[model samples]
Target: MMGRLTIRDRSLLRDGVKAIVSGDVEHLKQIVLTMGVHSGRIDHARLYGDIDDFLAKYAKLDLGSMDLGQIIEELVGLAREHRISVPKGISMLSRGVLTLEGVLAVVSPKINLLEILANRMSAEIRKDFDWIEEQKGRFRNLYESSQKGIRIPAQMSDLLRMALKGQAKVNLEVIGSEQPLASLDRMVNRLVKCILCAAMLLGSCLLCTTGMQPKLLGIPLVGMLGFIAALLMGIWVLWDMHKHK
Candidate 1:
């Protein structure tokens, strides 16, 4: 008969689940090895060897696309291979406290669970490439300046001095870099032009309704001029959009 898991067993299972969820294979391997030794069975010696082999194989694998369920199933299989009986769908508890299976049940619902992991890996790669390119640019600048038998540029010398003294400011801005708010400024300009066009059109319509104006062909002269202005502004707005596109 299977015995209820002790507090230590529950803690080990919790750590194992945490490691699996975090994609930390090394920690999971250590946890599994500890669990195997704690079992105190003679045959568990082989389980230790199996864990080592498992770690070596997974060390080179692309874990970003691997499903968490597959790893859990592999662990369960290892237990079975070592003659360790795992109670299937059986809760040995009156309080319904969560066990390994319970945690797995909650975590295994997402079919695309590893999609976020893949995205994170991609982001990390992009950051690494960016850092490398930045370092290359700094080194190239230094090399070019040295070849000319001249002191480094004032900005570069200042930066190096500040860095060496550990007083470098984080908010330094490069002179030729594009402004962060450039897009926002363009959006605001477009919105302002739209508002001006709309105001002109509404004023023209209102002017046409008024009788107090200089008459021009049974219409107010100011109203006619207003209409012409509004039309020209509308055309200008459309032309600006087309040109930008």
Candidate 2:
């Protein structure tokens, strides 16, 4: 018994025949539009010629299948029809025409312009990769320089934070007393400040007291005793602060 095919089966069969007849690109385009031809889908001007006079200019490009020149002329007409606004679209369509022409010449005159352009783009991509490697090398050098005790600029830290994933974060955590002052640092500063305050107050007291006892002030033993006491206290406080630091 013979069986009837479904709509999908018929469409697939038609697509297969179209592919064998036309080539890979046509088959692909047909498949892409199987659902429906979208509105304003094809630029008719790019597909056909719009003017008679302009056709003679590119008679050698084997454009027997496409009317790119006419398309350009029509796009120009579209510009005129739409005034200044149309001119913008006209310029863009003109460029599309040029690009299409370039694509067409990829296989003519015993040359492969497409492959050459591809190779050129490949070279450009490789150059970009090399540039990235050079930047990374410079970053490593800068990081090493900082490790060797060279002062890392504020910018370098920023760069590290931006580029490396976790390097800067770990470094920031491991480095001692970076931003928030440590407990020992705060303690040392507190002790030093206390010692300074004590010394200042004591000196002021001695000056005031000596003024009252001007006769006792001339006594070297008394002055020497006060100086020694201040010195010892300052030194002791400094030593404690240093130990805490």
Candidate 3:
């Protein structure tokens, strides 16, 4: 009864107990076991496995005298150790719900250090990008200053002006058949994309704050997935705009 259990087995026992307590007969019937020793009958094989010993131990327990709250706490601990998803009600059975940071503090302090390092790295990368843009702008200003007072021959200037005007008319025609609907549509699409990306980023941050279960690298899996999706979509949107521009 008291031995190491895999995530799948832990999930099975946790759900089974929840179902029993909630009177969810349908869910109890749906529980299936694919691993363990095989036998001619499924029930017989289940009885032959370590699950049988666990059930036996629980069956012998005097429920009338035992503390149900403590039992729930133990189950919750098992669920957390295995990273199995626990129901909200079961999570609230304990005195308090521990946040992700709290769990990290209990599990390992190194996880907190890693989180701080990740934050610092992202900040450094942002600073580097900003510096590059600043350098580019400085160089552009220097080049523009150097080009001042440069004069072109009148004939060449006239030809250049006419060519630019013709090109502008052509570009305007391409942008609009009869109306500015094409430009409007492009603007609307970009706006919509920006809104969606912003929402995704916001949602990702909210999910991280939730401290939901099934984490990846100490971060909520939902938040990680949301952030990754937002990043890919943002990159795609930027590339599309740059290509069109």
Candidate 4:
């Protein structure tokens, strides 16, 4: 006979569901182990056995036959039979896995399994390549420590180490490249010149509208000709800046 789930079981189920939805396998594993210890339904030995059984079942199937939805339905039925309360957001976890599977289907058949798993993990973590690079230093340190026998899986540790090394290599290349200050200075100068030109053109327009005939060398500055010339200069400056860019 199945036992009734307690409040603790519900809480652990919620956490496990969240981890699944987020694609956080590490957290999921931890939750599973904790739940097993608490309920005596999924100890370490049973966990390994379950994994082996799952893999063995799927090993004979092709990609098309891997019906995730059917598998989830079966799991839900089993949970019900066991008198376990299914966690909320279980649908979200299913959707996330289905999305990952869809992505894998579009990729090259020859794509490495490790790469595919890494991609799925990244999707679950909601982290991008740029974010990884930004935290490269911290990750590098963690990777080094993980080499000394961290509790994380070997594949995950290797992936983290690779990301850190890749980011470091990119940073080194950027540091060795030519400085961009000269280009930045040129851009600032161009922007300043454009603003000055625009200001002059606006001032000329104001003078013309106010019927003030400002002149330079008696050429009737701030008249139609002056406004036109200033406007032309502003446009030319903007065009020049665009060309430089």
Q: Which candidate number has the best TM-score?
A: 1
Ranking by TM-score: 1, 4, 3, 2
**lDDT per residue, candidate 2, 96-141, as tens digits?**
6466567666746444433453356557657767776889999999
lDDT (Cα atoms) of all candidates against the true structure: 0.63, 0.50, 0.58, 0.56
**Better candidate by lDDT, 3 or 4:** 3
lDDT of 4: 0.56
Q: Which regions of candidate 2 are displaced past 4 Å?
A: 1-185, 188-198, 201-211, 214-226
- Give residue 149's error in model 2 in angstroms: 57
Q: How accurate locally is residue 55 in candidate 2, as Cα lDDT from 0 to 100?
A: 36
Shift in Å, residue 18, candidate 3? 92
After superposing candidate 4, which stretches have Cα over 4 Å from the reference? 1-41, 76-85, 91-127, 131-245
- Per-residue lDDT tens digits of candidate 4, residues 1-245? 12354788756755654454445555655654555423324234444445345445655765445555444544444344334445444544455555655676688544433344435655855754467576997889889997866556876778789897884233343331233876777778877877777777677666655645566554446555656776787788778867976
| Collision count for each candidate, in order | 0, 3, 0, 0
lDDT of 3 at 198: 89
Q: Against the hidden reference, what TM-scores do the models get? A: 0.29, 0.18, 0.28, 0.29
Weakest ten-residue segment in model 3 by summed lDDT? 32-41
lDDT for model 3, on a 0 to 1 scale? 0.58
Give the RMSD in angstroms, all C-alphas superposed, for model 4. 23.0
